[model samples]
Target: MNIPDIWRGLTRSRLFWPVLTLVALAILNVVVAPNFFSIQVKDGHLFGSIIDILRNGAPTILVALGMTLVIATRGIDLSVGAIVAISGALACTIIADAPDGNNPGTVVFAVAVSLVFSLVLGSWNGLLVSVFGIQPIIATLILMTAGRGIAMLITEGQIITVSSAPYKVIGAGYWFGLPASIVIAGIMFAIAALFTRRTALGLLIESVGINPEASRLAGIRSRGIIWTVYVFSAVCAAIAGLMISSNVTAADANSAGLYIEMDAILAVVIGGTSLAGGRYSLTGSLIGAFVIQTLTTTVYTIGIAPEITLVFKALVVIAVCLLQSPVVQARMHRRKAAPPLPPVPSGTITTPVAAETAGVAS
Candidate 1:
């Protein structure tokens, strides 16, 4: 495609900004550090420390996939992190309370209970948002605050430890030379892609996101779509909780998923979804998650204070937003329309749009 057509196509995609930003960041990293791309296997296990990032990032990617759907409908679920806390607590409690030495079904039972609880929490968000007309952020935040307390009640404000082998394997084991968490993330992405891209539901979601009232007038069950997304988001969070608990062999009532909602939200935004709603892309979200994971990994590798990573992350998010924004892109396009300036006084910008958005975040 020519520049204008390509620009328009990208503007139409949810993943465009995130992918472009990820490419730029990766290029910068490779330029600055020669060892950034090095990898080796040790002890029959892939030993590049970057693998650690991919492993840890899996859960957030899973959660983001569901969150993308929710946000697509002009809604947000602040309760997801809380749902993770709830799901982990419920799972750990069941495993701990299993019959002393013969709880062979502990894994099965715990997962079942966890799913049921997540479903109920999701339904609650949907009910308040749909049936009662509560704003999504308010509806989910109410649960977000209340859910943490519920998690503590389940665990009595304590972390729960377990020894179940299967439970541990779900989060800690691997298949086909990949970490289990990574594999689960892949499966979740595939399912999401199938639902959003291969089925008619994707169109419905985009329609509702673009214009819910119009969708209602056109005979779509907009409320049902809204409810389904919240439920799916909860289920995804539950899976993340399970993987998280499995990794540590324990679940912390207070910190299991603390503030992860922010990261997921950033991932969705970086992936290029409009906060106002509509056009969603799972591929973009996946790439966005990878970039976030990579940024975190890069910050750690460079020996910067870990705390500084958040600052870098915030900058990167801002950059991505500006790069993908129509306001910025429109200006970039205008630069092509103007005549090139001579190698002049070396201090003045020849293009106004570039000068306006170049250093400024959109």
Candidate 2:
């Protein structure tokens, strides 16, 4: 019934605009592009731009899933990127030192060690935020600043080349005609989804996010949950690091997982999670990751300078965020939320006979 209300409703609809945007982008690609949907097999390998996105973006999606949980509790893990760097370095060091054709044990040993360190790092961040009352950003920032340095120290400032097939399989191997990263990401997503669904952790996270004081007063161990999520985020980063190293058959401490946590944060935001906390949607985050990767591929294919993608994507995300904000949503809901007109003044009701008489007279 009102212009402002209609406009706000349009902006606030979570599914409507995000879906429309995705469709519009696809349409644009189809119209102004060459075979955007076509897949090709060449040299005993499958090739497609879409497949490339699925392969390359899976790790980001996986990391973003963990980030979504962390942010759902109004927390951030700035050290995820660093964890990736360190994990890759750890893996490569083992493989590099292993004798020729003796990589199986080394790979397992390295993964175990890397996971242990990630767990500790995550626990440290969690303890700082939970027990010491440090802000999530501040706590993780301390690690972020030191993590890369630690990674470099692990690698001795040199990129370590690893020629292990098992390690490489994480990045380059295929299963069911898809990249291994895709499969691993899928498994992680399913497990996360199941854990959150089957347990009360999801509700606990939301309660803490919505009202931490209330959750604590209700006897919930909010701090423990917070700690668990930070550790989970570190584990995700480590897995991503392995995928990165496996793809290239080498680990570069300085380059692997560089600025990836930023990408993951952007993804969580784009997926409709409030930065202020209380709710999260992993499916949406997965979609957001795909959207990001699609844009990257499109930029490369369209001959647009790769550097422009950061600016372009940033602007697009900003626009989406503004549209998804409470201001816009509240405005949109007004028309729907307004009370229906009163049937008639209680004393002004007319009988059916009177209605018939009035009709006859008319």
Candidate 3:
């Protein structure tokens, strides 16, 4: 109803700090580059740094969205990056080997095969975690370690290139005056949000994350939920792989989606989703994805040395995490709520000892 109330409400929200950090990054970029926020229409499409950020960050956002759910169930998927590589490798390999790679039918078949492979990989991860009771990290690590090798085999230890016009549309094309990747990411985010929020699945996930044994006792089907999340995560990664490979029109088994799992995990953490599991936020992940992409752009825009870029990014992430920490927030709130020291009598100098004595007396 008033300023303090509104401020309090905002501070309590999970999205508050992430949104603030994104705005701060944007402001920093605009300060460095006057045209950072400028968007121009060209050939019926938007072109600008902002759009580029959205387009570039779309894959990470998709991965983070799925990772949010996986993490919500007290699980992690280190194999997502590998899945990304495998998906792209398989698709490109198939298309390159096809009789007519540019045909829509060939592209569709390749995509279907890639998606199906992703589903199998996801199921394997789920089986390890849900059925065998393996630790989530360990289960996914198995795939993470071997996934690239598998991809290499699929691509015959080389990069697979294709010339499918329809395939390129997935990553490099435009639709409705926006990047197609952005549209796809938006669709996936909306589907995830509605699927979880509109149904009882979200509550079940939180319940499982908070206490898996208790959830099982209450008949929450914890195993099924866990398995489903991993599958969904792999599928999301697969789609991201498609976009990445399609953008370049090639899939390099060794490099396709390299280290992307780290970025996705960082995005989820920055977006206010605890790696410890339980409640999550998709919108926060979206903002956090943009934050990461924008930060990367900032590094280039400001001309940071190549060797130091990673260190700089790490430092910024650390700062944001510290600011979002509960202890820091508590301290900040306490400081804000604490009454200001009664202004010292005008022009009166108080010795440190006298100030301490006065404070103790009060």
Candidate 4:
């Protein structure tokens, strides 16, 4: 392809700008801290700032992955944060009360119960939106508001801590020379990508997102598709909850996964998925999650005030959103393509009277 063609392709690619932003951030990080990208092996496991970012970012990545699918179907799950809290609360509460919380069987049982509860919560959301015709935001908001209270009740308004070594391994341990959380996130992404692409699921979701009525008329079970996505999103949130609670070995109902939904949504937007719905990219969302984590780390490395770190995040998000905006892009194109005013003859520069008369005629 010619230079202009290649340029156009690069500009049009959805992943291009986010990727560019991520690379820029990484470069800045390296500049600020020379060892930013350095990974070292200790006890047969990889450890480094970059590795920690991936491991810590894993939960957000998981949530964003599911959010991509839900957004692609013109839906949002505001309750994900609450679901995360509930998952952690339930599991930790269960494990804490067990005679031997560290037993593999106890941990497994607690995990199973948490997942099942999450599925039920997901079904509740699906029923409201798909069957009751409620708006996605409002429907999920119900749980968002109520879920924390439920979690508090589950833990009796106390933080539930556990001593399960097996459970701790899930979020804090290493596997195959990598963080287990990172491994889990990678596996989840792979599964989602393969499941949607290898089947007709992805197309159906896009169709529903583009136009639910049209998809229904076209013989697609749009309701079922929509319902399934909500459930899927919940499961993703539950798994993230496990990772989060595992990391700390405690479940604080009031604060676990707080404001996480916002981050997940932001990641989805940064990844090129529209709030309006339709197409999505899991890969982009994964990268967006890492971008967010890296930004947070960079803030700390630069010694920025913790309170003002959010302002930096806000600025970066605004920049990304503006860069992706079609209106901004179109205006830029117009400015570039507009011709410079024709050069007037230097010796015959118009007098004020002549210039005023020409302007009036125009």
Per-candidate TM equals 0.86, 0.87, 0.91, 0.92
Please, what are the lDDT tens digits per residue for candidate 3 over residues 224-335? Answer: 9999999999999999999999999999989888888988888888889988889888888888888888889899988899889889889888988887899987876663
Instruction: Please provide, for model 2 over 1-362, each residue's C-alpha lDDT reduced to its tens digit, 9 standing for 90 to 100.
Output: 68876766566655555555566666667766768878887665567866787899987987898899999999998999999999999888877877762467777888889889999999999999989999999999999989999999989999999788877878888877778899999999998888887789888988888888899999999999899999899999999988988899877888888888888998888788888889788877887777777767666766777768888778777877776787866664655557787688764628998778878988
In model 3, what are the clashing residue pairs, if there are any?
none
**TM-score computed on alpha carbons, candidate 1:** 0.86
Off by over 4 Å in 3: 1-6, 335-362
| lDDT-superior candidate, 1 or 3 | 3
Q: Distance (Å) between predicted and true CA of 131, model 1? A: 1.4
Identify the candidate with maximal TM-score: 4
Q: After superposition, how far is residue 149 of candidate 1 from its true place, in Å?
A: 0.2
Clashing residue pairs in candidate 4 are none
Compared with the true structure, what per-residue lDDT tens digits does model 1 show for residues 1-362? 68877867766565666666666666766777765567776545564545677898998898899899999999999998999989988988888888741255778889899999899999999999977989999999999999999999999988899888788877887677778899899998999899888999999999999999999999999999999999999999999999898889898979999988888888888877777889887777778788888788777666779768788888888888777788887676564556676566766666988688766954
Q: Give the Cα lDDT of each candidate.
A: 0.85, 0.83, 0.90, 0.92
Which candidate has the top score in lDDT?
4
Ranking 1 against 2 by TM-score, winner: 2
For model 4 the local lDDT of residue 205 reads 93
Q: What is the Cα-based TM-score of model 2?
A: 0.87
What TM-score does structure 4 among the candidates reach?
A: 0.92
